[model samples]
Target: MTEFLPPWPLLTAFVLASLALAITPGPAVVYIVTRTLAQGRQAGLASIGAVALGNLGNAIGASLGLAVLFSVSALAFSVVKYAGAAYLIWLGIRALRGGAAAADGGTVEAAPRSLRQVVRDGFVVALLNPKTAIFFAAFLPQFMNPAGSALTQSLALGVAFVLIAATTDACYVMAAAAVMPALRRAGRARALGRYLTGAAFIGLGVFTAASGSRAAK
Candidate 1:
C-alpha cells in the first residue's frame, strides 16, 4: 500500500490539501446541511453516504478516462453541467413551492422526504456535477508517484480524498443537526428556513451554470 502511494512529503502535502478542501463547505456540504435542517440527523447522514458514493463514482470515472472526455469535449461537459444545474434549479423550485404551500396552510415546514428519496437526491446531485470528475483528474495527478502505476495511484488518492471529504462532511452534518432544534423552536424561523434552503439551491445552480460558461472560455 505504501509502495502505491506518493513520497512521504508529497503524501503529507496531499493530506493537508485534502483536509483544507474537505473542511471548506461546497455544494455537497450545502446540500447535506440543508437536508439536516429540513429533516434530521438520519437524513443528513444518508445524504452524506449517498454523496460520498457519488463522489467515489466520480473518482472512479476520473480514473477510467471520463475526465479526459470532459477535458477535451466542451459539449460533453456542457451537457452534464446543464443537466446538473437544471436538476438543482428544479429542486429549488420544488422546495420553494412546498414552502409556499406550507405557509398558506399554516404549517412550519415542507413535506418530509423519505430516506431513500433523500439518498437518491444526494447521489444524483453529486453524480451530475461534471466538475468533480474534472477536478479529480486535474488535482490527483499532482500528488501521484511517477514510478507507480498511474491508474492505481489515482484510485488510491481519489479514495483517500473522498474519505477525508466524507469525514469533514459528517462534521458539518453534526453541526447543522445541533442547530436544527433552535430553528424549529421558532415558528417563523422554521417556516423561513425552507425559503432559505430553496434559495441556496437556486444559487448553487446558477453558480454551477456560470462556472461552466467560464470554463468553456
Candidate 2:
C-alpha cells in the first residue's frame, strides 16, 4: 500500500486540512477553557494534557483498524453518537444548576472534579468521537504510499496529526487563560464555562447525529 501516500499535491492538502481542523473550536477546546477558568490554571492544564493523550489513543485506534470497524457499523456508530450527545446534555444541565461563585468574584467553581475524573472525561469525550476515526481513516490515506507499508504510513500520518492538534489546542488554552482576570471580574465566569462546556457536548451530539447525512454528501 505504499501507493497509499499521496505525492506533493496530497501532502500539501494534508497540511492545510490539518491546520484548519486544529484551529476549529470543538469539545476538547471548550472543556480546557472551562476547566482553566473554573478550577484554576492547574486544573485546566491537566485537562489539556489528558485530552492530548487521548488524541494519541484515537490516532492509534484509527491506524490499528478501529476506523474500519466503526465506520461500517451503523449500530455501533449510533451507540457512540447518542452516548456522546447525552453526556453533553448532562454536562450542560449540571452547569446551569450550579449557583456558586468563585472567591475572585469573577468566576465560580461549581464542583471541583478530580484530575483523574477530568482526564477520564476527556479520554471518553475524544475516544468516542467518530469524527476522529473517520478523519484519520480518510485523511491519512490521502497522504499514504501504496507501494509502502499502509499501516506504517497511516500510523506516521496519524501521529503527526495528533501532534499538530495538541499544539494548537494548547495555544487555545493559553489564550483563554490570558483572559481569566477580566472574565473573573464578571462573577459568572464559572457559570459561563459550565454552560459552554455543556454547549460543546450538545453541539458535538448534533454533529454526530448528522454524520450519516454528511457521509452521503
Candidate 3:
C-alpha cells in the first residue's frame, strides 16, 4: 500500500479539478441530463448511479495500464473512440424509432422504460465512452507519486473522482426535476424533450468521431 495519502494541497487541487470537470457538461453529463428530461427524477438518479460504477471501472482500467496502451498506440485509441461513437449514434437511432405517449395524456413525455433498462443502458453508455476512458488515462497520472505505489494512488484518486461525479450528477437531476413539471405542461416540450435527447446522443457521436487520430501522450 502507498502508506502516504496525497498531501492536503494536492488533495485540494484534485477536488477542485474534479468539481470543475463534473460541472462541465460533457458527453456523460449530456447523457445524464437528457435522461432526466426524458424520464423522471428516479430514472435520472438511477442512471447517475449506474454511470458512476461504469466510470469506476474505467478508472481501474486506467490504473491497470490501459492508459499506457492508449498512449503508445494511436490505432488503439482510434479504434476505441470510433467504436464508441458508433454506439452512441446507434442509440440515437433507437431513440428516434421509439415513442411513448404520456401515461396521463398530458404534455409531459417519458420514455417507456423499466428501471432495469435505465440502469443497464446507462451503464453501457458510460462504459463504452472512449473519451471518458482516455480522460481517466490522462488525468489520474498527474496526481500519482512516482516513488509510491501506483496502484494505491490510482485507486484513491479514482474513488474520489467517482464520488464527486455522482454527487454533481445528483445535483443536476434534482435541478432538472424541479422544472420538469412546468415543462411537462407544454406539449411542445414533450416532443422537444425526445428530439433534444436524441439529438444530444447524435451530437456526442459526431463529436467523438471528430476527435483526431493522435492519442495524447
Cα error, candidate 1, residue 93 (Å): 0.7
Best by lDDT: 1
lDDT of all predictions: 0.85, 0.68, 0.76
Worst 10 residues of 3 by lDDT: 101-110
Local error of candidate 2 at residue 187 (angstroms): 3.9
Model 1 over residues 35-135: C-alpha lDDT tens digits?
88888899999999999988999899999999999889999999999898998888888788889988688553453468898898889888888899989
How much is 194 displaced in model 2, in angstroms?
A: 3.9
The TM-score, computed over Cα atoms with residue i paired to residue i, of candidate 2 is 0.79
lDDT of 2 by residue, 100-204 (tens): 334336454453467886777667666667656766787777777677778777877777777777778778778877888898788766557666655655565
Q: Which residue ranges in model 3 land beyond 4 Å of their true spot?
A: 1-4, 100-112, 213-217
In angstroms, give how far residue 116 of model 1 lies from its true place. 0.5
Give the poorly placed runs of model 1, Cα more than 4 Å off.
1-3, 106-112, 213-217
Superposed Cα deviation of residue 40, candidate 2 (Å): 3.3
Point out the worst 10-residue segment of candidate 2 by lDDT: 208-217
C-alpha RMSD of each candidate structure in angstroms: 2.8, 4.4, 3.8
Ranking of candidates on lDDT, top first: 1, 3, 2
TM-score ranking, best first: 1, 3, 2
Clashes of 2: 19
